[model samples]
Target: MRELRGPIGVAIALWAVVATLFHLYTAGFGFYEPRSQRSLHLLFLLPLAFVLYPAGASSPKDRPSVLDWGLAALAVAANYYSYAQAFRINLRFENVTPLLWPEIVFGVVATLLVLEALRRAVTPVLAGLLALGILYLFATEYMPGMLNYRDMSFSEIVETMYLLNGMGMYGSITGISATMVAIFIAFGAFVTGSGTGRLFHNLGTRIAGRQSGGPGKVSVISSALFGTISGSSTANVFTTGSFTIPAMMRAGFRPHFAGGVETSSSVGGQIMPPVMGAGAFVMAEITNTPYSSIIVAALLGSLLYFFMILVSVHLEAKRLGLVGCDPSEIPPWREVLKDIHLLAPIFLLLVLLMMGRSPHFAAFWSIVAVLVVSWISPRTRLTPRKLWDVLVQAGNNMVIVALACAGASMLVACLTVTGVVISVSTLVATLADGSILIAGILLMATTLILGMGVPTTAAYIIGASIGAPILIQMGVPVLSAHLFVFYFAILADATPPVSVASYAAASIARSDPMRTGLAAFRLALAGFVVGYSYLYTPALTLQGPVLEIVGQVLVNVLGLVIIAAGLFGYLRSPLPMPLRMLLVPVGLFLTLFEAYSVWLRIPVELAVLAGLAYWPTLLSTPAPVRGETTRRAESAPD
Candidate 1:
């Protein structure tokens, strides 16, 4: 994005403040009628997205063009129609309103604007996907196999799409985006602007920067911290990667390896609670589970995912004989931590959430607490200028997310209206026969394919609607199905070719993007496996007794370690090729044991123990290292 000068800058800034204030007011008091609240929500985002993100990279980014102004005015007119006549529209829909030309024109214009805004904010892939949703509605009767359904008329599609609570723009979990996700985005912006992000990075460096794999570990810790709030893997990469990626590279990690570590670690943010990514919010809404419950269930899974990344980087560092950063270069703990109150809002946010406040309530109060806490010290205070930046940044980030939700909702509207979602679910069940495991695998593949190249929240919206229903039909837990799709949706950012997170980190690390993506996928392997773990062992999702949950979780953690050892070719010492191959199935079998009977599990558990006993004996001879990296190699104790 470019810096707008003079009038344009002031105009954008004023609108941004108004939008933030509007949300803050409602969050403090209460929401307007659902339609009124959501329409106004989009009213704020649509115009800003057009002005901030242009038609293309070749267009002016920061300044609005004549076409942009027209889109902005159209956004106001389209959503305003819904806002102004909410009661009338509600009654009309209730009366089974017929096709109207005005509604049709508005819907056509509004849908086109939404698609274009999404194309600019996210990627063109999402815009194209959303456009297909409309086509699907009109073309459903022509679809082959289970996907075929009766088509809807064009006028009906238009009527259903134009309103605040319309099928296309408002329902199917988009409410979570308009409410919880928007507030959280603002909360994140305030936290970041108040310097809490640096505090996280500094704290990470203090804890991990002196280890042999310090830089990589620091990246994991810091990215996880920042990601919980930022929720955008690409944003997290740029924020934390600027420091961590360079530190890793300077600490002797190969550029591609460094970028991969950053990419995978940053993606972990969406899985981390108290604020998991946008997907978690939608999951809570769709599954009808408490947000706290969702977060609790996600806790173990989040740990397992990041723990594997930490272990992979450590093993790689060990195998390659990498070392920590210089002591002189490391920031002193006292200096870095002096203004730690900046993180108080995060703690408060979590506390309020655990206390059963609405997620938006918690987020609102947290933002308030941020404002209050930042006043404690001038160095950390949110000055007026800084606060303005926070509002603008919040509005900017939220627009992208809101637009992504709109695009995803277009699909949800199509699928729900056309009954194609059910057909897809039925098709999967048929393909899998009577086996739940096969059904789950098929759903995972479907979600994984659809999730790639989409935003986390949007990806989950589309993938879960299509995939989660299949698992539910197979009698799997609702939370399990949503969590399953959520995991894959977040993972799509690390998958190769179009791995946006990896590509972002690669640019920062100055590495080959595809190599970084492939390496990220490899490092994130445990995530893929664990997505299935919770399905087989409900204990992993905290569905069982406390002891059983602990036991199951521990077993899965150990299994992840064993798998990482095999894939990364290291533990205490490097494993030879054959041992690496042997360890793979040993890990896989042990994981399966947790979900199997004792008669079968005990034998598998012992087999793993046997490998554990023998691994150290066959350890490969380690090579020596040279240069600055070796200077502080002794800093980390064996």
Candidate 2:
């Protein structure tokens, strides 16, 4: 495989920087401009598309061939032309007669480009969905039942695909990407540049490395912290798991358990606060809520998730009787403090956001902070070359996100044009027959299934459009509905059958992916219950009176502990099978409904207290090991 020459690498880097700057400019500045200028934001991705082929490749086979480059260039050009034409026309046509042939041509090329880009950047499943949606667009007239749509000529279809009326590449996905999504991504990149990643890892090690399941706890804490800045679950797993997975294995965790721990914890990052997955941005757009509110809700979920992970690690440590690292090996406080300056960027970002600044402004200034902070310590200072590299890497990362956004934008566009969202929502509402819980369940199932292969942003947009309204109609709060779907969408990454994060972790641990996925599912049981709790108890969402919210939080925390203990099957010691079985359903009932009959609640509470009290006794008992039992039998027989 031939490596990229210095000049080529530099060129690719410049292209990415240019594209990102264009996106930032259009997103942050174009809001006051005419609609046409706003639409021009689509062109920002063109240079990014050009650079991505070279940037993503790492080998001769991976490198973009001449033909690949040509195709990419054509796609970008077509996308630009389509956006330009749509902006000029501005809904002037009532029918398809006034649409231009160039629009149709662009649509075809853009569709092809989106598919190829998905194949290169994401997984095959996403690519297939894009193809399927485009196919549906072309063959809508022949479909039967609820999927059927009005027949349109090829030109009409192209016109619809290229238009800017809340559908097409210029609609919700790209619109949000242009605004909040880009800013947060930039914020994350800048924080990373300022060395927040290292700080998180070091802090995680210091806080958790003295425990029995120290490494696993470290993975959970570090991954959750990393998720605050790096919203991508796959990236989170590789970054923290590379260190923690091996450590866990060395500390005596089974390969599958280690992999499952990392996978589940890494997947939690998407639901973390501040810079959650792109899905949160889309949710804000669709629901018309402040971005900060979504961040708050996600923060709540993340806290619960990380707490559960910590409990799991602690219990497992107790079960295994493992020891902590030697004190001599621990890093000194003074050394850890030396890099504390790196945290300035993140602190500034949070403060700016809390102060009501736009995410774009917050991100831009935070980048400046990162650059300045990096120079404060000579050891961590970014050379001019490294600064340029950070800019370039930021751009490269944005391209993968941009292309996925564009493809998802196309899918969303189709849903709008065909009125599929309304249709699907109507069908789901009818199925629920006015029950909010049933409607939410149906929506949850749908999002989970769709999200298995689709990116979270796309899944959230699709689910929110189709599922959220049903919940609202059934009396569920709008924020709760959208957040519920978003939570389930992220959980799909740790879900069975097609759990991408689990598969990645399994590869690293050399374990069975299915088993690892199931383990992750078990560990994440509390999250699933929390999803239902949002519907049952709005207080968990910070919506009720202050006192009520506090009380609800207390109950919810207790419920989480009960569920965790039940799932682990040990408190201070191994729980009896009957007791474990009983606690599971009791925990779910208390958590999900928040309404426990006094009879059931009192008995269950007492039983849990008794179990806790008996924990020490259980652990102290000398249960015979399998090997010990075998030796005693052999000696007796002789």
Give the alpha-carbon lDDT of every model. 0.82, 0.74
lDDT of 2: 0.74
Among all windows of 10 consecutive residues in model 1, the one with the lowest summed lDDT is: 593-602
lDDT of 2 by residue, 1-638 (tens): 12345766666567767756665565455552333433454455544454345433442443455765687578658755755565466657535446666666776776666677677666567778877887898888899877899887777766655655556665556767766676677667767766777878788788878877878888888898898888888888888888888888888888888888998888888888777788877887778777777777666667887788788777777778877655654567776787889888878878877787766677777777888888988867878777666666666666667666777778776777787888888898888898777887898889898889887777777778788888877677888888888889889988998888999999889999999998888777767876877776667677877877666565666677777777777777777788778777877777666456333454556567576758777568788987998889888955
**Highest lDDT among the candidates is held by which one?**
1
TM, every model: 0.93, 0.90
User: Highest TM-score, which number?
Assistant: 1
Candidate 1: how many backbone clashes?
Answer: 0
Model 1, runs deviating above 4 Å: 164-166, 593-638
Candidate 1, residues 1-638, lDDT tens digits: the string is 55776898988878988888888888878988777788889898888877877787677765888988899999989888768877776667531668557777877988999988888877788888888878887887898886688766777778667653645786645566778888888888998999888888888888888888889999999999888888888999999999889889989999999999999988989999988798888888888888989988899899888988988888899989988778876789787877698878888988888898899899999999999999998888999999998898888788888888878887788777777788777778788897777887887776667767678888888888888877776777889878888999898889987899998999998889999999999888878877887667687688978877766766777777888888888877667799789887878777755456534554565566566657676464555576656767768688
Off by over 4 Å in 2: 1-5, 24-59, 82-87, 94-97, 597-609, 615-638
